[model samples]
Target: MLSPTLITVALAAAMIGALAGVLGTFLVLRGQSLLGDVIAHASLPGVVAGFLISGERGFVPILAGALVSGALAGLSVQLLRRGAGVKSDAALGSVLSLFFALGVVLLTVAQSQGGSAGLTMFLFGQAASVLRADLLPMAVVGGTVLLVLVLLWKEFQLVAFDREAARAQGLPVERLEVLLTLLTAVTIVLGLSLAGVVLMVALLIAPAVAARQWVRGLAPMVWLAALIGALAGSGGAVISAMGQGVATGPVMVLAAVALTALSLLLAPERGLVARWRRQGAARQALRGRQVLAALRGLEGDHATPDYASDEAMLQAYLGTDAGPALARLYRDGLIRPAARLAPEAAARRWELTEAGRLRVEEGGQHA
Candidate 1:
């Protein structure tokens, strides 16, 4: 029984997630994660400019303003990269501060006029503001951005992973980069209406960061990021509905952060816990092999037994020296005590079981 309002918020948030899948890949690959922050800050000026020109606080005009300002912000970054001989860090820092200042000034003037609605929401974001009218442009831009990212997946990866190599192979790295920057700007503009300028920033990049933790390559990362973003979006909407006066934009951001944090701790290959477990498992396997070898030499047994037999021999062969490795091997089923053997040597010879052999050869316990 989702209220229409909740339903709308959830849907929009999910759509936002889908949008982030594309935008995140580009940002991460280009090493421009901070650019999302820069563009978010820059959108203040864009919003004001849109309001100034449109003389009203409509969605289209505000988004248009956002687009222009965002483009300028990106353009400034490029100028720094190519023309000013400045690094991206310096360029983004300078432009972010400068554009934000201008935006603040204009916003002050606009607020002083005192007749607009939803103006301040741009500073933090207000997801509850989403309406049917806002969806059209967002749908168009979000869809287009996603579509382009999919179609140019190879090219984007080329630009992202090895720009020089991609260039050597004659890929249009420069043009594609420009397109990506513009696409980021457009995404910022679309997000502004719902998340506002400052808060929308988080939604832009958090899902992608989360996706990276969960994946090895670009495509999976993009898709995962989008799923994360969408879940956050919908979750935020639902929360805002239940909690009175909750801010939509910030809620969405928090959701993205939660997903990212979860990914860091839980993602299969790259997560902290997962990696630790894998390493531990590997070490265990190595230790098991060593213990078996020690017992094998001690028992004068050279290979005619299963893991269980190996365990039995190990107990007697190494005696007190069978050690922690011997115990672990038996516990993990890599070895066991042989029962049907000579009364004198039944418990003292070691051997590798099928699994034990595989473990020894695999090179990694996790494998």
Candidate 2:
């Protein structure tokens, strides 16, 4: 039996996560991941102003203000990049610091004036405070963002992967870039109540980063990221409900980070573990080939078809450990004990099989 409040909070957080995940994919692909952080910080002033103007912690006013503030911050970065020739990183940093400072000052002023009791909740978020009334508007905004993304998928993809190429292809790269930025800002605003200003960027970025590890294509990556984000959001909400005085935003961020770590360690083609295994396998295969070629060379030089080399001889010839390679080659039937070929005299020496000789001659390995 779950309370309606918890259900509502979970739903709200899930929607926020899904939206952030989808939009954040583009941000991540465009190498503008820090843009989410900039928007999150810049939206803070708007959040405080929205509360001040409404005289209440209403979701609509706060989100609307945050959207405007975030969009302005995005535009400011562009303007600085284009007009003042400031680097994108510098512009983003400047806007984030400026807006966050203004937000802190406004928050202090609102605190002094006194109707701003729960206003600070937006800083770190209070998902427990979410009401059912917040769901409809969040759904509407999230749905619209998703619809726009669906409609402009290809164009966005093009702009994301290659802006110059998109421009050369006669696409409206600038307009598309601005639209993507707006979508990112809107998504960040939607998550503000769930992940808050401080941790919202993590929610936006972590799912996409994790998703990237598991997928190579953009569409699949976006879908997987949304799923991961939703899971993190709902799971965090449930966990927070189970504990006393636990904040939902931080929990959600931690969940997302955990998912990212798992993806980094476990993804088949791209994970650290997978890459390490592949590299080890490649090194082993190279060593096997080297040992085979060395045996073949030794036979050619000595005019003997069956040249048996001991582990020490192979190690000296290869200038590295040869035990693993020898074991692997023996397992693969590419090499065998020299005693099998010469029962008369042998001191645990190895010789290349016909397959190994053919592999070396062909300059390739067996599948």
Using lDDT as the measure, the top candidate is: 2
Global fold similarity of model 2 (TM-score): 0.94
Write the residue-wise lDDT of candidate 2 on 1-367 in tens digits.
9989889998998888888888889989999899999999999999999988988888889889999999999878877887899998899899899999999999999989998888788889988778898799789989999999999988998998988999999999878988888988998888887788999999889999999999899999999999999999998898988999899999999999999999999999999999999998887778888888887888787788987776677788889988887888889888888754356644368888898888888998641
Candidate 2 regions exceeding 4 Å error are 340-346, 365-367
Per residue, candidate 1 scores C-alpha lDDT tens digits across 1-367 of 8877677667777787668656876797778888888888998988888888889988778878888888888888887888879988999999999999999999888878877566878888777678766566678878888788778878888889899999999988778888888888887777775687777778878888888887787778777887888888888778767788888777878888998899899988899999999888887666666675564444345443343344444556545455577667767776555564667653454455566556655643431
Predicted structure 2: lDDT: 0.88
lDDT of each: 0.76, 0.88
Winner by TM-score: 2
TM-score, every prediction? 0.80, 0.94
